[model samples]
Target: MKALAGDLGIETAVSFPGRLTTDELSSLLGTAWINLHFSVAEGWCLSVMEAAAAGVPTVAYEVPGISESVVPGTSGLLAKDGDIGDLTNRVTEILHSPQHWWASSRRVVESRGWDRVAEDWERYLTVVFSSA
Candidate 1:
């Protein structure tokens, strides 16, 4: 990737830091400019959601899982599935606009916190068992 970019006269340096520990992951989210989630399949992307929580925007494909966390054009930008060119464009779009960082972060509306989700689940189970 570096060689390709260099060949194209692009000066940006890209690094892929493989699997980080929990603390490292947290730190990365807090400090990174953006999260690019390219997973083809996901139930829902915890990383994407966490990025949102950390006020970092994401660039992802428009699939069921990623869609749950990334609100297209708000929290982040989305591209049609398998459209690498579109995804690249979206990334460039976000990086070029300075205010987009704040706007995307502020616009992210988390669906629910883990505590709330757990509470709702417990309440649902209690009601179902009580009726049974």
Candidate 2:
């Protein structure tokens, strides 16, 4: 990945701070412009819902479990599965179109009540990660 970035003359400034705390993740979500989910498969992704809760729109593939979280034009943009070109276009569209981004963020925020979801998430995470 680093080699490709360097070869393409791309200044990859982002760093992977391993294992973020809840506070750090929350802080990131608050400032994030958009959430990008490239997971090949997920079971009702919490990250997607979390992004909606923070008023951050999402760009992801149109897959089963993920589709439940992202409401296409309403909550976020979705690309065709395994299509990088489509994913790039979706991300670009969300970034360039401010009104769409605003509408998505507003709709996501208006439609979801995250209080109960958050509690469920904590419990789910605990159980899921305990044996990981």
Candidate 3:
């Protein structure tokens, strides 16, 4: 992780192997200057959601679940899907611009949040419970 972070010209930290706790991870994410995830495929990115909840600005590759997770130019910046250069450019854009950072912080909180997710879940559960 450190090597990759270094290669990307960013600072990195890791949790104890096989002992990665969500709260611990969230704490680390909370302190991050910026949270970035460049995965090629994701069914659903809980990490991005968590980072947004932590009020951490995020940068990620624009892919299937990613678009749903990170609201581009708001909660986080997304590189053109399948374009590495675009990813790099988006990251650079966010890192260099202070206004973008503040905007992202607010966007993440307002848009992508567990509160909203939980409400959705609750609605679904309510329907299920009513049927039961």
Candidate 4:
């Protein structure tokens, strides 16, 4: 992770296994942090969802599952799925361009709250109950 971070010109602080618990990870992510999870592919990745819930914008590769998870320019920016140059450029943009990055952060704040998600669920449940 450090190497990947360095290649992207971002400094990374890693906690060895057992060094950080879930609360610590949450706290670390709760700060002014930009989370990156550039997996080649994923299936309903919780990290991306959790980061959005924590109000942290993300940078990820443009792939099928990831695409479903992150809305580019809103929750995060997408780079070429397997191209290092594109990844570097996107990461650099997030690191150096505060406005674009914060736009994503604000997007998260605008629509990713628990209240918003719960409301969606409530609506679904209401329809289901009424139909039943």
lDDT tens readout by residue for model 4, 1-132: 667767777654553345677898778677755778869979866788677766666788888888878877777778888888988777777777655665566566558667889999999999999999
Candidate 2 lDDT over residue span 1-132, tens digit each: 567767877746644556888899878778778888998788888888777767778999988898888988877889999999999998888888756675567666565667656878899999999979
Candidate 1, residues 1-132: lDDT per residue as tens digits? 667877887746665678899888878777778888998878978788778777788999988888887887777899989999999999998888747664566446444666778888999999999999
Q: Residue 110 error for model 4, in Å?
A: 6.1
Return the TM-score for each candidate structure: 0.66, 0.70, 0.66, 0.69
Model 2's lDDT to the true fold? Answer: 0.80
In model 1, what is the error at residue 8, expressed in angstroms?
Answer: 11
Winner on lDDT between 1 and 3 is 1
In model 3, which regions exceed 4 Å deviation?
1-18, 98-103, 106-132
Judge candidate 2 at residue 129 and give its lDDT.
100
Q: Rank the candidate models, highest TM-score first.
A: 2, 4, 1, 3
Model 3: weakest 10-residue lDDT segment is 11-20
Candidate 4 global CA lDDT score? 0.74
> Which 10 consecutive residues of model 2 have the lowest summed lDDT?
9-18
Show the lowest summed lDDT stretch of 10 residues, model 1: 102-111
13 Cα displacement, candidate 4 (Å): 5.2
Candidate order, lDDT descending:
2, 1, 4, 3
